[model samples]
Target: MHLHCYRWTGRGADRARESERRPPHPAFPASPLPPMRTCDWLLKPRTRIDASPATVAEAVAWLTRRYRSAAESFLHPDGEARIGLDLRLHLAEEHLAGGVDVQWGIWLRGGDFITAAVICCSPNRHAPHPCPAAS
Candidate 1:
């Protein structure tokens, strides 16, 4: 149930400057502030589905239904299954105009669900590696 969170830098320098201008708290000395993020305060309740015995077809169906237009599935070199989704669409129909992109994904291995995540990144950046790296 661990969630990996990341900071999102907005469209341009303006957002960065806005964050820098905030006064430091009395207890801490003035320093550069972290960039603002779109999901800085996301508090939505989360539900975990145990897919231990679920067939590949069932898992695919569930992910497809949940993610709709955003879902993508792939097979790893080690035979694990992976599913991912671009979640920003939940907020707006169009891609942000030079804003961050938000995504979520899961990994299934040995009939058990392994890892899941929500990632936020700059629109111009790509994942550091391939979806399910080649051995």
Candidate 2:
């Protein structure tokens, strides 16, 4: 497994330059913009994996648990607060042939869930696509 952590500064030029430096994964095409709202601004820790769905689910579950616990530390009884989870799953043919790339993220504001989403993108070369309308 390989891990690549990114820190987002909310700069479009920075993102574009970064993208230019690294070619998209052969099995997971790149997008002009990510498919989820938070995904566009939140930092992502890249994980390279060749694993089954069960393994992926397990990893997500673990991260969810940890996020919940950490979120509490950021909470205050008399002020606004925010916490979230941002996950990106990139699967190659060698790992899961024909499997789509997945991106998921959620945000909690003032201890309430304000957003949650999951998006899938085709693992093929094509023009960039936009994210689906949020529900």
Candidate 3:
């Protein structure tokens, strides 16, 4: 008989990539930089907002300015996103020519911290390291 061990890597390192994952609970880093690692360095825009926006619309606008394009099929005739927070807005998420899944989203933690990012989730399983699409 044999036992197999699973290395319990951080979900961010697992196949289902997301910006939602954060450091373990209760402890907060004193560093000014956003708590980012791995693919984030390879994916997001250079600007990161450390302060929260006054409203969801503010956040949406910030993300929109960074990414001017959207998946036409996912948006309205006005080029706005189908989903809404309190009212409505546009979100950018689309598949690249090579089948790369590109997604943009906002990360929020209370009224003090909020930021937006764009990540090109590897076409293959997992992140760039174990991903066949990486070269």
* Candidate topping TM-score: 2
* Each model's backbone clash number: 0, 0, 1
Q: What is the lDDT of residue 16 in candidate 2?
A: 39
Q: Write the per-residue lDDT of candidate 2 for residues 16-61, one digit (tens) a residue.
A: 3445333343322233333233223212212211122334354444
How do the residues 13-124 of candidate 1 rate in per-residue lDDT, one tens digit apiece?
A: 3333554433233311132222233232121111121222123233333334444422233224223222123332333223222333333333322322222223222212
Runs in model 3 lying further than 4 Å from the true structure: 1-22, 25-48, 69-88, 91-135
Candidate 3: residue 90 Cα off by (Å)? 3.5
Candidate closer to the true structure by TM-score (higher is better), 1 or 3: 3
For all predicted structures, in order, the TM-scores are 0.19, 0.24, 0.23
> Residue 59 in model 2: shift from native, Å?
3.4
- Residue 46 Cα positional deviation in candidate 3, in Å, after optimal superposition: 17
Q: lDDT per residue, candidate 3, 1-135, as tens digits? A: 110000111222232222333333222122223334433323222232222334433444545543343222232424333344323233232222232322333322221222233333433222442221232
Error of 2 at 134 (Å): 37
lDDT ranking from best candidate downward? 3, 2, 1
